[model samples]
Target: MRHSDVLVVGAGMAGLMAAVTAAKSGASVSVLSEGAGVISIGSGAVDFLGYVNGKKITDNPFNHLSELGEMHPYNIIGAENIKNAFASLVEISNANGYEIKMNEEGLNHTAISIAGTTKPTYICSESNNASRILKAKKILFAGVEYLKDSQPALAVKQAKQYKIFADAEINSALLKSPFGKTHRVLNCLDLARYVDKEEGFNWLKSELSKAAAGYDAVIIPPICGTINYTKHFKELQNLGFILVEAVSIPPGVGGYRLRHALINEAKKLNVKFIENCNVQRAVIENGKCKSVIALHNNIAGALETEYTADNFIIATGGIIGNGIASTPDKVYETIFNITIDSPVSVEERSDKNVFGSHLFARFGVKVNSKLQALDSKGSPLYDNVFFAGNTIAGYDFPTEKSGYGVACSTGYTAALSALASK
Candidate 1:
């Protein structure tokens, strides 16, 4: 029933940035996302590497793009455009009051500096916003018992080391294995009782009822249902607590909140959203996409929705996020059915330092200079369908903590070009 100039899917960093830029350019845009994991338990910072141009560790955006091609030959082909993407991202962030600073010593993809292992430069957005909202107040870091016991306590201790003032509280909810022994853990948010079950919800209400009035916010560990943050916020709001926001992923609360925020923002801009609207196939006429047929819900309850667009930008995330698929044996884009050119080799799967302490640290989707989705034969799939972010192939951001950085750059640049094409 609705039509837009661009139909962008997924609400991760790339999706959000793409939608925002496209909408601002006066193009009607809509975003659909099944779910996203980037923000929840993700590094809440934009990452970019630095190079030593002279005595200074010059953070040249061009050099960063070039290095990506050298390391992951299939990773980046639009090397010049990639640099422009980063430049656009820097411009946007600087204008938004978030100043991204560069590291001095030829920035490594990943590094362990005094500051909880500093990797590439982190462009902080909500830097002042997060602190401003929590000014001089204490936060209750509600701990999921099993999770704390399972993973290294380094992140928690490191948060304290960074002087992020917060206190930890353990939830009594326990997760056990078949033998009735504790296997993993769940926080108040994760426990079935507190989330979907009525009894647990009541218990959470009664227990947190008092503390809700005292603290600034209740910080929860990334739980299974954390991605539906709007729903979570409603529950918290009903109990008289202001749901500030969550941190970035492994702990998924932040990504959920970030997705919710983007959707809400889009709605405010009069952008239409059709969730569960799965694009089944694209109709191309004369090498340009004419329309896209989508399935809403399922066959019995499904309604076929057709959207005709002048252009399209694919923000679907990479393999790990379901935008693209790559196992030990194969790699391909899921929606458009495009194959990647020279996907990451199995040998480079895990570098000797499994932790990934180098640049282009994570595996990324490979793309040409125009960011077109490429096939296994190294041919461009479609001229109209451009891509951004993790789906591009070759480079890895998780290891580099440059996931957000690359995603933003690629997303911004893609939207700009799509608009120009129009």
Candidate 2:
């Protein structure tokens, strides 16, 4: 049996943030995860809220929180807590050698994607700062030959369509394949590993200097080193070129770098991380969660391990992350088997339009302002148990573009609430 003051389930941004926050406040924290969360698949930039009332773009996302319904996670987290959460995340990133920069006015900035689509994000990697990219009069879209995901020519054509960059000259350039002919299809992971080495950096510098000549800023694939992205950014800056990293595709190396930094910071705070443990059930006693039973894999066979904690936080993520499971007529919280508040019938969940609202995306465990999990009747399930991240659903992530921000804010708030519990 393992015991801790705080036990957090999941290793995604929310779970990691909760563990780090609790541990820093002098609570003994243990984190268990089935696998790495959605970070690797997400764009590295932190999106607060990009759209409101459907596809309407708002300059200041924070200003429109009041417009959201009562069930929205941002409203439940409150504005002050959201600010504090971002501050804590920035501090953690800086301490771990990965600096994140946000606008001074707390407004969202436009981040250019590899496909040249502009996305509204609150905080972005210093290397991908939009302000620097916007200042350039001439921009060079650079790609590696044989790169599977990034297309320089296509990006240049798409970027030219946007009126925001009309004044800047958009050009395309292709450098030699960073990985040579070893692999037929070069992925972002390969590029990231290549850039981490000194020889690879030198090769890239030489190639970029030639391809990016006469251009004020060079937008390139996010090949920044996974562990030392900031270091690579500085080294590239020393080559006398203004560099901007494009928002990545799935298996995002930049996101992986951010995740690695968070995990390293958590370790510094003495947070115990237990990977490959799938929590199966929670033991409730006297209206409180006493412990959880997890399935652990070993050479012999699967083993059941009991972990007892004074308090527990569920950051297990949403349907996409498999924190909540759904069927034709039912939605369920996996660990506690709590009934999710969703449509009663399958017909109510189905939408005829392909890009229409998905009821399942909004199905998750409900939590109150204190971050405590609530039953269908709005009652706390366990006094010592709380929920954070995608588990506490109220908003659609794709439409709102508030998923990462909500995760960070709710995770931070959940930690504070858990630490104050009796």
Please name the candidate that would achieve the greatest TM-score relative to the true structure.
2
Give the per-residue lDDT digits (tens) of candidate 1, residues 106-130: 3332222212222334443232123
Check candidate 2 and list the clashing pairs: none
The segments of candidate 2 whose C-alpha lies over 4 angstroms from its true place after superposition are 344-354
Clashes of 2: 0
Q: Stretches of candidate 1 above 4 Å error?
A: 50-65, 70-121, 125-184, 188-249, 298-300, 327-329, 342-365, 374-380
- Top candidate when judged by lDDT against the true structure: 2
lDDT of every model, 2 decimals: 0.53, 0.84
Q: What is the C-alpha RMSD, rounded to one decimal, of candidate 1? A: 8.8
Q: For candidate 1, what is the total of clashing residue pairs? A: 23
Error of 1 at 186 (Å): 3.8
